[model samples]
Target: MHKKVKVKPNSKQQKIEEQPDGSLTVHLKSPPVDGKANEELIKLLSDKFDVPKSYIRIKSGLSSRQKLVEIDKEG
Candidate 1:
């Protein structure tokens, strides 16, 4: 499955919110430096979807606040 995620890095708390438009808003405790936010994003998605971190891949926007992610359906 593919998901559109908007990340708010360096947040006081970590959370994931699903919007009415079907996109996701993710708050991460990690900063957006040296892939820390990306790692946190993968871990959060993995836990949320019951999949491994390896099952999620950032398809685009590696350095931007918005990102497109590809998630394996097999889990």
Candidate 2:
């Protein structure tokens, strides 16, 4: 599945909120540095989707707050 995620880095807590438009708003504790935020996002999505970390990939916007992520649940 493909998801549009809006990432908010350096948050006090980590959370994922689903929007009405089928997108996601993710609040991450890690700062957007050296891919830490991206890693956190993947981990959170993995847990939410009951998939392994390897199943989640950031398809686009690697360096931006808005990202397109792919989750392969069949894996």
The TM-score of candidate 1 is 0.96
The 10-residue segment of model 2 with minimum total lDDT is: 66-75
List model 1 lDDT by residue over 1-75, tens digit each: 899999999999999999998889999999999999999999999999998888899999999999999999685
Candidate 2 local lDDT, 3-72, one digit each (tens): 9999999999999999999999999999999999999999999999999999999999999999999999
Query: Each model's TM-score, in the order given?
Result: 0.96, 0.98
Error of 1 at 37 (Å): 0.4
* Global lDDT of model 2: 0.97
* Global fold similarity of model 2 (TM-score): 0.98
- Pick the TM-score winner: 2
